[model samples]
Target chain A: MGVPFTPRANIIMTICLGTIACVVTSGCLLWFAWPYSDYERHVGWTVEQPVPFSHQHHVAGLGLDCRFCHSSVERSAQASLPPTFTCMTCHSQIWTNAAVLAAVRDSLLRNTPMTWQRVTNVPDYVYFNHSIHVVKGVGCESCHGNIAAMPLTYKAKTLTMQFCVNCHRDPGPNLRPAENIFDTDWHRGPDTPGPAALMALYHLGRRNLTECSICHR
Target chain B: MRCAWPLHVLPGALLLLAAGCDDMSKQHKENPYASPRSAPADVAQGSVEYHDTFHPAPGLTPALLQRGRSEYQAFCAPCHARTGQGDGMVVQRGFPAPLPLATAPTRSATPEQLYAIITSGQGVMYGFAQRIMPDDRWAIVAYLYALRRSQQATLADMTPAQRAIQP
Candidate 1:
């Protein structure tokens, strides 16, 4: 009946193994729980639409302004969607016979707003002002990226809180073509005005750009 | 006696691992904002235009106003007050008093102007840009107008057919 180790010793070994397994399980769980963002967190997302809209056709082909749909962006906080009437401003005469114009016509006849799925969405906690950012010289492309070239528009930047903080951390180099601040491809390398020049201009008589309270509460 | 050694060793190892992270606190530390903020004094005496992008929506509907009211209560009533008179308890307790919207000149402002202010906070209030989506802000603007009309409208305004047309 004499064993190498007592039965009490075996119980102790079992308890130790159980504790280690629990610790390992928790460690793995926490590893998965590490705070990575969701698929929508990426700036660019594509969704199925009622109609396949093409920014390339409207903007690049016909040279429509981004403001066409997001009309209130300059005088309002939002760059609101253009109602059916706005589409008809050009479409009613331009493409009245086109089969693709069904959604636009439906909105007008039914008096409903076109349901454009948000391709670019940020988290609720973040605060982004198109007006302030636009006025300050940040180009549409700075965050939105290369819009004229994009056929089907998708978000082009990682709009994470940290992504915002980095740009706000130093907003100097982001501004360009003051008049063409809406252009997506305004900034490029050494020959073009550097961030320091822009930062100096941005901060010329204004306050610091690093104030969290400026962007946050 | 030997069994106790591993237990003590495990905790010691964990403590060492934790100490290693303390060394990387350089980037993790919260730094005070490096630049000065725009002071209240810097704002123009008049309305400062901030709408860099403004697109017209489908306009307002009574249904939109109702939805806006529900959203306003959820997000804003904590501070802006249910009636939007800026009398919320949080504001009275010194949580940055919202501008009294009932008496606010904002009530007389255009829809776009009202939309701008709500989208991008007027003064002490920061923009609801991220908190409330744009459509919701537009809806809230519609509701704000409804609230003003509810206050200013009378039986006379409604019974216009009974009265003579204004000269």
Candidate 2:
């Protein structure tokens, strides 16, 4: 009877501990889950645009060059979006009445440019140039994956800093001949030189590709 | 008194954290080209050449043909070689080559016929009608004519400096 504390005190303490345990368990789960989530990387997630332009059909089926639409890729920092007039050139002749192309037709009618949503994006702080990478013999498929096979166009690789570091540390595997830059299915053949030889050919010496100034302005 | 404050703060912290879980599913905007505002003028559009309804433009000038050459390289060089020999990289890969634009029959083709072929394709060649504007088609046709003419040029066609450079 000398004990001042009752059984109710023990019950309260157990409940508080149980709640704390539950919270800690869920916190760990969420921490691991966020990176593995589908939305974080946007892999396999197709963005709906004014026109559901299929890179698969055009690049693979039709066999058109990437520069046909991304005209400034070779000369500029941006692989710029094709102007409305480029779409109108073909739309005005065929599929002129398709409901799906109504936005495209409306742009031509209203004289407005069509806006395409960007699929793969790096942070604004990071400065990436398309022309330099292209001139240096990096194939489109290196960063873009097998774009010819992508029917709906999604972010194939996570644009994380770690991902960038992995490539910058060693760009040999991603290197190809300048002539074969547009060849999506190109791979090193048995007769072809090794990655070291290719690196030598492209003049990619043992320089640090992952320097802070390399990407960060 | 046994950490009553921690219990009170825990649920509130959890509620705040749950609220911060952003929904990135709707990141992309719908109706990409639905904007009705007047489109910004394109610099390349200024180079386009449209054949008038009644009168064809006079003999192709060097400037006009140069614009045509660039336009052709951008749009036609993939399927039609820069030489207009229908030996583009796409054809070299395995695509069935279209008839060379510098052939005798192609040379005989009227500007309108060449425009139609570009707009409505032929054989296995798919139409670029939607992608290439009418004015650019005329530009390509003019360049094609120039290419054919250059193929048959004689020493008389060259200037003194050009003749000196000729092999």
Q: Which ten residues in a row have the lowest lDDT in candidate 2 chain A?
A: A86-95
Q: Which ranges in model 2 have alpha carbons more than 4 Å from their true place? A: A1-38, B1-41, B47-74, B77-99, B104-167
| lDDT score for candidate 2 against the true structure | 0.73
What fraction of native interface contacts is shared by candidate 2? 0.15
Residue B72 in candidate 1, Cα distance off native in Å? 38
True contacts kept of each: 0.00, 0.15
Q: Give the alpha carbon lDDT tens digit for every residue of A72-96 in model 1.
A: 5655555655555455544644557
lDDT, candidate 1, residue A101? Answer: 85
For model 1, what fraction of the real interface contacts is kept? Answer: 0.00
On residues B15-124, what C-alpha lDDT tens digit does candidate 2 reach at each position?
99999897543344432233434323333432333552533544567877876776687688766788888887666756667787777677788888888877766665
Per-residue lDDT for A64-183 in model 2, tens only? Answer: 778777766777787767777666544555566789889888876766677777787766667788988887778888878888988888887776777788878888888887667877
Clashing pairs in 2: A89-B129, A89-B130, A90-B129, A90-B130, A90-B131, A91-B130, A111-B39
CA lDDT scores, all candidates in order: 0.63, 0.73
- Provide C-alpha RMSD values for all models, in order: 22.0, 10.2
Candidate maximizing TM-score: 2
Give one digit per residue, the lDDT tens place, for model 1 in B1-167: 26767897999999998888742313432222211221111222244347735557546787788767755764566566788887654455445566666675876688788877766666655455544567777888788877777788776677757555564
